[model samples]
Target: MYRDGAYVSEHVRPTTHAQIQPNGVDLTLDAIFEPLEPGRITRNDTEIGKRQRVASAELDRKVPETYYLEPGGYVVRYDEVVEIPEGHVGFVYPRSSLMRNGCMLDTAVWDAGYEGRGEGLLEVHHDIELERGARIAQLVFAEADHEGTYEGTYQGENYETPRD
Candidate 1:
């Protein structure tokens, strides 16, 4: 069975009441990056290619920065850190607003026990401007049986210690 939004919120950090949905929590955009080289995958190893951070523009100092993206592919990092609890698998889906605007986000299955501020591939089919911290995706969890928790290179990625 799928978990409710309130229950899923317990596993995400830096979240607000507004981000909690009926079925999941919304994830905001933290940053964007463009791939500069090709990545490689093999039976024994994998390597992510070089990427450059896409810069966002701020028209007014008081306003949030915005990215003027043309139709293309980019990598978007989520602002919140998530921890998938045991016996649950996490899935990140693009919000409908993105699709209405001609954009799509592709993500991988988040295995049980995965923890990180994860990333997703954003494919833009039309020109669009995205503001930093804009709601871009929803994270939901479903109950599942697993023999073990995830322990991979991406564990604890982009995690920072909280300040006192």
Candidate 2:
């Protein structure tokens, strides 16, 4: 139920662009993601470089903010908590502009009633260079009808990315 300005339709011509675009859209990131020691930029530690296709649990460990992403790379930061209603599915895809720029958006299939901070994964396909805080993807929410929901269902159970 996406509407332009007031009501965004499921599929409609975009008011912002020449072609149709989805409603409730987000922009490129303003800040870049980089590995920092003690969350502070030392300005000398250049060991932290580009990371690609690797899923690391840096979020599990508390580190201070330091450097940002380099060229030919993409980074992710979590936005608000988008709760998929009970009996619905959601998808996240790379923006067309980002695709043209050779940036890859790492997406995930969100199940019904999924909770927690919605962070993203950044990836690069070719050896192209990019900056920090770049537009990567757009999340499209869809509604579904599940009969006898929660009736002996394994879904609906919520768990964090890392559970201790």
Instruction: Please give each candidate's TM-score.
Output: 0.94, 0.46
lDDT of candidate 2 over 1-164, digit per residue (tens): 42331222222122233223434444333233544333333666424344433233344343332222335344564333444556566676777776786657787676656654454556655444333333455656666765543322224222233221
Q: How much is 12 displaced in model 2, in angstroms?
A: 20
Give per-residue CA lDDT, model 1, range 65-92, as digits (tens). 7898999999998999999999999999
**Minimal lDDT window, size 10, model 1:** 56-65
Q: How close is candidate 1 to the true structure, as a TM-score?
A: 0.94
Judging by lDDT against the true structure, name the best candidate. Answer: 1
Pairs that collide, model 1: none
What value does the lDDT take at residue 16 in candidate 2? 34
How many clashes (backbone atoms < 3 Å, residues ≥3 apart in a chain or on different chains) does model 2 have? 15
